[model samples]
Target: KEGRKLEQTARLIQKTAEAKNMPATKRAALNMQKLGRRMAQGRMDKKQAMVRMAQLTKQMQAQQRQLAQQAGQAALGGGKSLSQAGQQLAAALQSQAAGGQNAQGASKMQGAHSAGSKSTGEKSGANGGNKPAGQNAGHGFNVPGRNKPGDKPPQNALHGAAQPTPEMKQIAQALQQNNAQTLSEQLRQLARKAETGQMTPQQQQQAAQDLQKLADALQGTGMPETQQHAQAAAQAMAHGDKQTAAAEMRKAADAAEREAQQQQDAQGMQDAQNSLQDSQGEMAGAQDPGDIPDGPSGQGQGQKPGGKGQGQTGPPEYGGEGNGGRGGGRGKPNTTYHKGQKPSHKIRQKPGYGADAPHWLDPHFDPAKNPRYAKLYFGKPRTAGPSQAGPTRKTRPGEDTGPVRSTVPYYNSVVSARKTAENAMDREDIPPAYKKNVADYFNSLQPQSPPPPASSGAGGTKP
Candidate 1:
């Protein structure tokens, strides 16, 4: 039976070999080698546990060492350098393109970040959906005479390739439908329009760029006219540059600088106001003069030199206190005895001389003029009325009058005088003997004249 089994196995193996290619058996041998390798690595519970424990211990030690180093660095108080990410963020904010502000500030933070503005690149990243300034060239986006994909004419393209733009298809269709006459008429219209200067400045720029793109697109699209038009447009656009862009930028910068300068001036004015407020406060706290501190100096203001306080009282002024002028209360003038107190004896009536002015009013009217009449007037009083002659007097005619004043003495009173004279002599007015001698002598002198001479003078007058 064994022999029969072996023969069957050999027969089955031969049949399998005949049905397949020889390479399939080589692959079978490779598969048998792979199965032997898989069976050789058997699972072991105890040995695997020991290896896992060792690995766990080693990993724990390494982690502990790393933690210890970190702790030591923290305790040493070392300042840390900024991370690469933070540094890059700061650098981006400080870039030249970001003239006004830096990167982080583009988001508009408060406090420290608010002080510096954000960069242009950062702003572009922030608001690129809008027309950001960073990517703008002087003119239109596409350069002149440049090829544009998906913008070529369909007729000029390879078969089964992308279709052409609407403008390109329109132009191509027009060209296909035109003869020389129609094309010439269209060309003439275009020439007239160009000569009339129909385009605005912006439209001209866009048109030039579009023509260049069309020329490049038509080069392989079987259109020679488009190529010429593109070349002309590109050259004209190149020469049309006037540096207007740079002048606009400079003008903007100058305006910004002026605004900043005005801000600084406003800040300076505010500071000056603050300083003035401080000075006012100082003055407000100051004490008045004469309210001096300890030794007669005003508080804070100090003492003036020579026993005076700064801003102190002035000198005792005239016409003040006890020194009032005329009509002053309780202050009197010196007593002076004036001359007009006495009366005068002499009087003259004249116009406007009411009582006469005063004794002191006139220069000559002095009470002390004469020492004796110091209290009296110098002249007599005036008569009350006109003068009258006394009663008329009669004289005896031719009565032996020699000189009217004195030829002989009057005798009628002589006897009466003799008696009185004798009596006055008897009273010793003259001594008695001297009086008798005077009488005897006068009686003797009366008898001594020449009587013949008197007779002779009378006889001559009679003859």
Candidate 2:
């Protein structure tokens, strides 16, 4: 069993070594494609495209250089697959980068020519030549091999600006298939249609196909209920029942989330299991080897593998807490027990057993009176941190404390409270008298000005 385990470990190590460059290489290729898509869609302008293309090309070159080291390592591990894939992807990226630069330059030149043409036409019109370009250019204006405003550009137009390389497309396709993001997006679109109460026959048919694919992808993940819901949704879509389809798709989405969480937990459990198995194998191998036969040299067959010393004759020292051996002292044996009962050890006492805790542990205990605890048990007070410090109020021993001024402005605090009380008062279950009192209290709390005095006598001469 140990030999078999060692063989498996060796194979896993080799596999890991061969795939060391896979993730970064794949990422570089996919980023190149995403940048191309952005440029083609006009989301990225010319200067930005040039800078990004240059950076991506540089990254690909660096990744290629790293591939050399990876290749050497993989060769020592007996494989060159990673190096080969990296080389191919790097070459593709370089070629694609060159093509993108050329296309961008061409587009820039075309834009310059168009600007020149417009300027020349404007000058000619000013000088009494033919009407300037774009005159009467609106609805119903057509020019051969050209698209008007608000018209969808031809597919060739996108290709002319920036085209994705074959390697990038393959990487993107593989990513999309592996991830559930596309599945979730499709379900969202179907849900939108259902919400709008508008699902055409063609759309319904397409949704059915998407749901079927989702069902197939979810197979054997211990989520048969999700699969069933997905299939039922697909069937309902085919029958043109948007409501039923939407409900089923919702169930499928919830199940998929749960399944994802379960998969994550299962992966963690698998890692722990592998660790436990490794430890168990190590312990088993370290066991007594005295019974095995000796070789012709008359040497004892009790030594550990890898030319180590003789097998451990005593208990192995596992550096864990509690019980037995030199690394950990043997715990006290079980002694206290009722009559006619088997003695057993207890790591903890019953619930009420520790009610009379030590004096130092009491919640109300003051460390200030105990010099030992005051210096050792208590930590020094921390200085004020980022929060603002407020003024500390001091008063004589018999002075009465007045209402403290609020930190917040009265208007800022009272408005929300009054609004809440008003809303609560609107409830019919409360007595009208209580509501009147609450309203009067809030009204009186409002800020008021002192009444004018002695104005009437000064304004009038003698009445």
Candidate 3:
């Protein structure tokens, strides 16, 4: 009986130790391994591990309590085996938790409890040097390049470069946006070269430059983000200076500026963007119905860049008839003209110019097949004044008819191009001077038309 009692006591003590031991479940072991590795990497120290372990222990205690309650209920009902096991497990955990064991302690125990076996933490913290410059003793607190030392994070962004601030993100965004458009073409070119199995050094250099510019811009914006980036760059350069030495230097300098507190990230002295946006709104609200737009800015609309006139091509009905005035027409000033008349295919050739009159007329104007002006003249062939009122042909021969008649279709074509171009350019908030040039170019293309047809034998003979 005495021997049995001693055995029982030993068993009880062993069980208690087991409970306190906090079984290294696969998850627990993994966590321990991770902590050990981090410590060895010089990324963390004993204190950091302790903090983490403490956090984990709290979670385990909560789970243990719930299990105990379930087991207690079972035991009360006479279903004792499973309940017994739960009770034992609960008691074990309670003892450890009561002893104030923390996650950090548990993690350290994993290292101390095992030996002769290699471990991540031991391997990493191998130098046995405490507090290496760049590495945190525990919990990944190291700045970049401790053996090399990274710059401290921007003070404004965090207490001491610990967390990213909103300003930092904005700076990053600006950095990316500034370079995005310009390098789009270059990116495409590189992609093409890769597909074709070759890349040029120049292309590679340009690509690196583009990326450097963006990274620097973000860092220099006085954002906490700069610290993270700065660290990364330092690490990259630590290896016998870096591969992209020149490029990295540029990026670092750029970031240095961003990290400066005096450089306001937003609302800088040179910011002209807001004024530009207001200008755009004014332009949107101020679009004219009569102008036919043209330019790289005007797509689908048949106008030229700089608001220069392009002769109408194809059928006139493809586009609505030329705007007669500001409110009614698409490309020109809306006026009393075409008010009563329904929109039609009439091409207003040159206006107010008699048939066959001057050399200054549009050189591209074709009488037989110019679709834009054909309708205006065709609609009212006899509209020209009578011969007594005026000669059909102003010149005897070889002289031009000033310009072609103002045909509804052709006039409307001009209006379409002008309007579309104007809308696009205006939206972009281009300078007023540039916009004016666009407007003036269109106005110059208005075709001169003939007077009412002559009544008797005029110089012109009609088929």
Candidate 4:
């Protein structure tokens, strides 16, 4: 369990690394408050203020674009699993004639499809056969990777990375608009004019109006009240009301700081930091013992210098008699040969005879001693349960009403099977009547649409 926790923590670290660099964005948000304060105090020159404004806008726009791109990729990845589901369903339906194999294949496919759907919804991607990355965010806690029945799961470093929040796409769309981009350009132009001492009164008024528009764009970012004060400050500037503008800007700056603190509190950022610190302290004081023997081949307290002196430390072909010796016993096959030397004779064994052989070349083996040898089963030994003292009692009245139990067929399978049958109907080898019957069967299995509401004059029920 400790090892598992370490693995999960490592995956969580990788996931956090893959997440958008929110710290940079958050710092930029906080810096806006500082910028507002400098403006309110008249501490910075107009040219310097404008340059800083332009830089901050560009930084925010870049971050928004990156978030938008990530969200888009995750959304596109979701549809991919549905396509894979269709393929699995089609293959299962087509293999119905294969008896038990078909049943087993269908059952496994259905399980994987359901698991994948759940993983997609929860953004955990714990299912093994799931495609790599972008379909989900964080890994499920202690959930083992689930591959197909007989297949190995594909490895991915970023598999733990979850989908971006919906707010990311919304915020990006608002901040990356033409007006936001134009506002940045306008700031740069205003800065250049102020630097050259060519800034006109009308131009200053226009810059204030542009700033208000930028603040309006920011209103979509869940800080409407805070940004509203920024808009008021901009309006005051446009009317040549420096005192009111300064006061409003100062208020806006304070509001932004409060908002940031509230956000950190609500998200439990401080708690997470504290927990991480505690974990680090514990890890720092821990140490591993070096004296324990690792395995049979390890050095400490062993039978010999090379341990048990298995074939691992012996000649490939001719080894001393002991457990795991290449001469006999349970060692690996003798594959090493001199450059020009070959065995004088070849040894052959019947099919499955090698299953009990220590080395494939040795066919004279005892199956009774081989743990992996195929065994015949008579039947399962039955054990009797406790006998009741009296006659069987009828189930209680409420027992039957506990819950409805039924096997609900998946809609994707129905759709896929119908599609496959339709394709088969187009083939010339199949009879038209048979094709029609198959089509009718699949069509009946689909969910039916509800009937439309009756019109006022068409026998509609009175409210």
Residues 279-346, model 1: lDDT tens digits: 33443464432121111110111111222111111111101111111111111111212233222222
Best by TM-score: 2
- The per-model lDDT (C-alpha) reads 0.30, 0.42, 0.34, 0.38
Candidate 3: tens digits of C-alpha lDDT, residues 344-366: 22222222211111123243333
The candidate with the higher TM-score, 1 or 3, is: 3
Per-model TM against the reference:
0.16, 0.26, 0.17, 0.20
Clashing pairs for predicted structure model 2, backbone only: none
Q: Compared with the true structure, what per-residue lDDT tens digits does model 2 show for residues 1-463?
A: 3333433443443343335433443354355446545655667544575566567656655554454343233212323232233344345444555775676566556546654676565654456333233332221122222333455433233222234323233422432343334334445556667657675444466556556555554444334555678889878877888888888877766654454333333333233234334534463455433122211110111111222111111101111111111112112112223244342212221111111112323333333344433312222222323322121222232344454333444444567878887876676322343355457556755643333354466575421
Model 4, residue pairs in steric clash? 128-146, 136-162, 137-161, 137-162
Q: What C-alpha lDDT, on a 0 to 100 scale, does residue 247 get in candidate 4?
A: 62
lDDT of 4: 0.38
Tens-place lDDT digits, model 4, residues 1-463: 2223333443444344335333533444355546656655667744575566567656655554443343222122222221232233234323322443444455456546755675463554343435543222222212224333444433221221122112222323433331223223333343444345453444445445544544544544433444677688678768876556556655654554444333333223222233334433444454432122111110011122222322221121221111221122222223334245443222222211111222322222223443322221011112222211110111222243233322333343567767776776675223342345356556546644434566789678642
Error at 237, model 3, angstroms = 7.2
Q: After superposition, how far is residue 435 of candidate 3 from its true place, in Å?
A: 49
Which candidate ranks first by lDDT, i.e. highest? 2
Please state the error at residue 90 of candidate 2 in Å. Answer: 26
Error of 3 at 199 (Å): 41
Error of 4 at 323 (Å): 6.9
